[model samples]
Target: MSTSPRLKTQDTKARDAEYQALWQACDRASRKQEYLCSHHEAKRIILESACHGILDKRRGQGKIMCGTSIVSMVHLHLQRDVNSRLLAEARMSRFPSPPPNDMPCLANPVANAGNPVGYNDIPQQQQQPQRVSPMISAAEMALRNEVTSLRQDVSLLRQEHELVVSSLQILTERVAKLEGRQAVLEAYPNQGIEGRNAWMLVKPMSPRSQTQGRDEDMVNKAADF
Candidate 1:
């Protein structure tokens, strides 16, 4: 799962790099076109100015002149020649054959009906029928269902285990409290027998006299024992 995201990020980076390179190439081409247009315009202006000067000189000599026409023809011929050379260079730079089409139907002879030697006409190997026991299959299905049920049971048992652990913790707290009380009782040897007798004696006494009576009886019992 984690690797999937990393792979996607790598793919995105590769695509971005390709696009950046393509855009740079396009920008370079556009700049070259602008430079060529500017150069052509400057050249045409200079040629026309020179041609006008030559025609003026010829007119001053009082002679019939075709200087402007000759200049125009020369310009047209130069332009055509330049255009032809550019076209030839472009054609040479291009691939001799067009890039192969990647359309699945055209590329895959097996899937294309237009191909006479397609896989459709080939004889396929006959597959033997697999022999299977119905009882064994039923048993496998039952086992799968049992496994699924067991997984659910295991999850429920985990929850129950947590609850049992919590209950055990509460019980342990209560046991600790009882043990502490017992430790306190054992700390005083004199209080041990008296504490037992106080619970054992069924006779009721007034609250004011209870303590005194319990102590006196405890002392008497200790002496007798």
Candidate 2:
């Protein structure tokens, strides 16, 4: 029972890895863009390189990639990358920098660790603007997607299990009736009380009945004893 969902989760991890690879590929493409003109083909070429770039450049080019898709993916990746950088720049610019002669503000005015004060000790406002990684958000979104897929898979599995249980219950009823008729026919001439009893004895029983009449003789003897 657990095997199904465990497999699904494992599959989900694989799914997550696939997207991660794409995102990583996209990031690599965005950074190593060969052409500076924001050319779609250029971005696609860069991304394709990340995936198939291990080969010699000439050989890699010879290998045909589905460029339209690559361009679309890289375009989105770079767009997000640019957007994040812009937002970071906007935030950094929001604050005015202190004059060169002014004392830099420090969150920890006193060096508690005995470390000397330097730019490292300065507050974030005074620090150089760093590119905020979009990976965290991308990972979170992927996790949500994975969880959603897992739920869907689990739900379908549960429904199938329920259907199977119900189907078996129905099939059991059908088999019991059919087998009784078969047993009676097999005992043609003696298809009376004895044949009915034999059919009842041999045919399948439901969970509730548990073949209560099975081994009746032994049970009776035990009771009497």
Candidate 1 per-residue C-alpha lDDT over 1-225 given as tens digits, one digit per residue, 9 for 90 to 100: 366988778767755554443333322322232223445666455445544554465468764432225444436644764786588567555644444444333335667767765433333455555444333343464456556556767998999999999999999999999999999976643422356465554443444345565687887788998
**Which pairs of residues clash in candidate 2, taking residues 3 or more apart in a chain or in different chains?**
none
Q: Write the per-residue lDDT of candidate 2 for residues 40-154, one digit (tens) a residue.
A: 5665567666654423332445632222344455567767856876886786556544444445556463656675653343334444555654444444644565565567679
The whole-model lDDT of each prediction reads 0.54, 0.58
TM-score of each: 0.23, 0.28
User: Candidate 2: minimum summed lDDT over ten consecutive residues — where?
Assistant: 63-72
Task: Give the clash total for candidate 1.
Answer: 0
TM-score winner among the candidates? 2
Best by lDDT: 2
Off by over 4 Å in 2: 1-3, 33-41, 48-75, 88-225
